[model samples]
Target chain A: MEKIEVIFYIEALSNEKKLLERAIEATVESLKGEKSIEVKDISVGDILEDEEEELLKYSGVIEARIVGSFRDVALAALRYSPAVVEVLRPGKMEISARELMEILGDVAVFMANLMEKFGGLAIYPKLDDLPEPKIGYSRDEIEAMIVEDRQILYRFVAEVYDKDEETARVNMAKALSYEGCRINKLTVQKAPNDDKKLLLAAEVLSDFETLFQLMAKYVPVALSIIEPEVIDVTAGELQNALTDISGFAQELITRPLKKQLMDRANTTFRLNP
Target chain B: MREALYWEPLEGGKVRCKLCPLNCIISEGKRGSCRVRKNIGGKLYTLNYGKVSAIGADPVEKKPLFHFWPGSCALSISSVGCNMHCRHCQNWEISQADESFPYLHDMTPEMVVAIAKRYGCESIAYTYNEPVIWYEFVLDTAKLARKEGIYNLLITNGYINEEPFRELAPYIDAMNIDIKAFSDEFYMKIARVPSAEPSRRTAVIAKKDFGIHVELTYLIIPTLNDSEEEIRAFARWVVEELGDDTPVHFSRFFPHYQLTHLPPTPLETIEMAYRVAREEGLKFVYIGNVPGHPGENTYCPRCGKPLIVRWGFKITEYNITDDGRCKYCGEMIPIAGKHAKKRYGAEWW
Candidate 1:
């Protein structure tokens, strides 16, 4: 393997000046502890206090010549989130197929785990906690059907515009008997000085068109289909979905590394000039 | 409200609407499947009778009835509501709307005929939405239009039942029916209808039985229906059932309404459909939604010469004799009515 030198520009923020300075010193010392890396130089800037945030932030750059394989350098970037990484020497490096796959697999697993954690936070009030409906199928039953049979369910709250409330009830009764449909609730309300209208909330176990057909039976003057507020996905499906997404994520993760190490081997930037 | 035809009153004020194959059993004060026909006091009433939701003076070719009165202007009108709930409806604003749409304009049959004359349109086109759902209004207007020597054209999905279609067939002079696709699976999945057999059956009856000038349109969606085998089957059906001269249009599908996730139909797919249809031995084949392709023009079936050159909906060149014979090879084109002179680029306003 070719030896490559890289410069990592990193930043650390803390409420106290001592802690901010200590964090940067410890990061450089940790990088030198690795046997495959040689610490060439460490430059630390003065800690500055921000009045807006009420915190002291210190910035530093570490110049290290790494003599390890490609996996070691990539693992370093994943371990420390640097503001920017610049490769200084041995512009281009090549690795075997196994190393490339290992690097991508590590990033994919990390991303999948992070997404799962955040997804768990976003999904709250488990399906069991939802109040049971008085009229139709329970949420748990519907959720189970969605996962098991892969049946898509749609909820439509149709407003039937009519002068008679009895007619709306009769129509709702007929619609409830339609195949693959369940009436959750039906309410008849009249706006002030306006004609009576029926607000019928129903769930249809079919595609968008079947749901529409179920609603059209009422002859609604106008209707709107409401989107489901919460959806729960099984861990198996989430893993499969993330596996498909990882292929695209691999390109996003590797483009910058390839550009810095291979594409711009002879290119140099003068920041002060 | 005008009393709707083709409905039978069941026991207890309920009525079964026989207007279309859907045959929705409607309760009193409720509407049938179309959303415009309501059952009131033991009678089915057509709520959209003479209710015009949209109106335009469009070129007949825009309805894509290329063989029927080639360059004539048609007074196109629509009343809201549709029979089938197609996921990719191009005119969902009107087709998916109810009779309570705020922009509805009330125009009687006489007024529609008068407007057609006022606009110098030779034909009145019941279009934009499915005219089959607006059964009562279209029947009344077409009857009046026929009496006034004006052609009645129905641009529809042809989802109507046989009895209603037969009663209204005499008044209709020409029809451009959208076939959607050939497979029943595509129909069930995308259009949410049980089958597309009704559309094919209607086209055959309109052409063979009634002798009404008929044309077919198939909007080709990417993976939903566009396949060489499917297009060939459609073309073969058209040739066998509606005859070889029934002009078939392969229209390009754009992502619209609920199908916004899909990409627009590629030009290559449209061209492939055109080739496939022609390979099935259909004489008159055209491509729609594409402006200047060679497939947009009408060719002499016998001599293979471009008889009429069109750019979009405008006829740029006409090469037919006074008697409807091709000027190039004297081949008798299966034209329905006399060709109207070019309305655009003329000195007369």
Candidate 2:
């Protein structure tokens, strides 16, 4: 009978209590389900409660010893456990816990083995109180959302007649009525090479027709300085909406969307350098 | 979240949602594609139920019901979620937003009725967002509003299945359905739907089966579905399927949402489309979004007179008599509404 030992570190968010419990249970369950490995007692110990401990410390410990056929056995079995499985929460909020078996499989016992060789030994089953999100979308529901349309800030360049910020503001208002749009942020910058030129950046939300109608009235050049980036559209235009719309089009780049593009093209070729 | 209207249990703690044509078989803890319907613990739940995203008072004419209670106002309400991802969606924000978005206002069906009565709104319109997706909310509100003698109107994309829509029929009084485009290709690619036939069927059922007042609006996006053939076909279909007096609104499509790169529907194209619709044996074809245009007025087809004068949402004159007959020719206008005569009697006009 061959015996194998594996260890790894896992850190959860500053919160999430139930998460720690399920992670530990799932880890233990995986080893229990392995048919080839004759189970020995699974030891989950070591409360990392040193009075002065702060960051980079252990929270708990999980150790299991079992006679197995493969070099690394029980951990590989846990990967297929249906109940204590790791699942993504679909969209932006999906965060996964670091399963000890999966992590130890990839990262290996480097730190623990190194520390053990030097006479220091400590380990914690790192997890916190983050809640697990259960997402159960059927085939039809997923397809509907996938086929749904998304919106992003549509940026278009228009030659402007005014350079001053006040006139630029007026030009925007004159072009698109404030009835539909709300300007959330505005930044002012000077043209890199030419101090005589000024750039006006304002984040405004309106319909595509109204936004372009107003923007086209003002020129997009720095000297002409009429820029209204789409900060957010009114709620009327958000049904079946995509949360992130920045990828919809690449033609007109807004300030926050890609501020790096605002730099002067010839700045890299400055004669002074 | 409210329990959804139509869904069945699937294997492995999943549920198959039968709300719209997108029969989403949702796994446990996952949501259907609408973002409002979630599969929680093997049960389908509608998240947008009673969660009002946008609500306000709009003139019934704004609903463009043209025939249904023409001059009255409706307390329009909507929650988030739509069946299609139309590139030119005008009200995409609330319609496309998830149920958790901060702006959603919580209200019950009873409360909606109270608001309409308080505001003197003759009807309550489930609008702005696609009303079909908010079925539970609309069903509750529509039933309550009907009992209160307040009309219930659904301004929707009309992308709904027969059973759910028919279930809503008894309570819904009128609906302003957006036809989008007459072609299946437009519905498949631009509107992101399997086909346009189902949507057309919803309109038919709304009027014929349920006897609900129905009006259709076709957004004329330039260089897309604004061809004369589509407009003529749509007009012909209305006459054949619904009727000649169906009141088809040829609304000018401005570059909106994803279709912003294109220009606002050209006036020439709208004029041509309007002419084509009228020539195709359709009565009551109206042009919208281009304010103060002569097409905004409702003219008597028999008398050849401007029967109802309007200046963009404002009714300047109504020449229909107390009996729903045209003043000049005494021709029945096929109009169904609470006329001024109902309030002021014979001496009003």
Candidate 3:
């Protein structure tokens, strides 16, 4: 296992010494067998001494450090530790990629709740540098690993689109285009064709107007793909990619055209059958 | 109708109102977002050209500007319309409506100058509304006021674009710009504007670029934005970006306008905010709106002696020298204009 070192800069020691000690104990317990932890300094030390005197005068030099395994499990455990929690209180606790996905899942559920309470305009999401999930991953894996972890992306969309569902849907659709997926229909229809391949194909058929309207209704789920600039593809590349999804291409092509007939059938039968 | 100030015609029947941030691109018979400037037949016309809706002889300290003119009465005048629609606006009646409102008083620029001179006021404040929205009127009055040896003051939201702000900077002697909150969320939700970051940028520009005496006021509303961390971040930004010498006023927010359901900000919250700002190395942090509070007085950052004693808008005692130095400690304070007993009027808190 590769060794990864983490640092925690603690401040105002005199006011919260007992709390700090408890946090350190919790951190030690959490990191047991995972990696090594050390208390480097208790007093102010030079972090940026050579910089301007004014800058140095404001920030008191006291920082902490924690060393652990670079593996996803160890890193996640270290980040979610109580000591880390106490130190980074009021700010989002930073964690490894795997842990980030878990947090993102929690965030997605939170976004759903926020949307229900305040309406669609309250979801904003952001994503940083992270690899795209494998193309053949299941919907569960995609939702858990890639879709759920990006918080900033959701927060951004929530703030921008707020209550305006169409814009939010459009943004989400645009985001989905990165994963070669398109959200063609956001209905309760869950048939055998309602899988990742079909969903991805459905997304390709989406236009900006339709996507925007969808985003407005649903709370924006902030998901970042492997690439930041996904909209820069040529028209030829867009068409070729959609055609590549061979298994669901025919079904995806007729999905939009079949929506009217499905609605008409339900209305004619009164759903009594 | 008088000729307007700060405008130039464009090529294709468009007149750019170079007054504020909106830079209103006017089509014939259409008005800008401010509702003051209109494009009439390819020419820009200011509707609130000289319409004074509110006029008062208020204590200079009441402008909530402690460093400028210390304690004096300024003849304040304002026209209707604002570039931004802040939800917690205290003066929305004057700021939100157009000049066509029933309360508007028809006073020309010259008449405004005359009224200030008649009231024996040392300065004229273009306040009670966003002065930038009434650009032509403010510019004209400022010109006349400057020529007459009277100072021009502005209590503005500081949301104007750079060009217009620079154009108006020369005339404005002192300003108290409201830095509503540090975050973009607060700006969007509370101010209903795109960027509050611009206001901070403008403050630095006002102080460094234009050399205008600038002070900042932040209303501490409970639950919404009255946190120590937020206030500390704000103070640190001000001290770092604007400078430690820049006086920051942490004003108490009372339930008003659209945000009335929430109770008035507690006095302790204001005090805590003041403490946070002070702890963040801000030299001068004062509390406003809550009268008789100790934070209202200006004290020497080094010696801790009261430099300018104030009660509400009244100056009970003045100990600073002519050069704005403390009498006891001899430390220089960052105040503008000359010191005179006549300027410091007697007003009970």
Q: Kindly report which residue stretches of model 3 are placed more than 4 angstroms away from their true locations once superposed.
A: A1-273, B1-18, B24-27, B342-349
Residue B247 Cα positional deviation in candidate 1, in Å, after optimal superposition: 0.2
Q: What's the TM-score of chain A alone for every prediction?
A: 0.39, 0.23, 0.25
lDDT of 3 by residue, A99-142 (tens): 33343344345435544544433121231111221223345533
Ten-residue segment with the worst summed lDDT in candidate 3 chain B? B340-349
Candidate 1 lDDT over residue span A1-273, tens digit each: 455555555556566777766777788788778765565666767666666442223334444444444445544554554545555544434433334335445543554444333321111111221222234557785665456544445544545554577555555444343223434445555544656645655554432223323332332333333323323323333222222233223334544554454444336443321
Residue A16's C-alpha lDDT in candidate 2? 32
Off by over 4 Å in 2: A1-273, B340-349
Candidate 2, residues A62-160, lDDT tens digits: the string is 555544422233234223211111111122221111222132222123222322333221111111211122223354543342233111122222222
RMSD of each: 20.1, 25.2, 20.8
Q: What share of the true interface contacts does each candidate keep?
A: 0.00, 0.00, 0.00
Task: Give the distance in Å from residue A194's predicted Cα in candidate 1 to where it truly belongs.
Answer: 19
lDDT of 1 at A243: 29
**What is the Å distance of residue A80 in model 3 from its true position?**
61
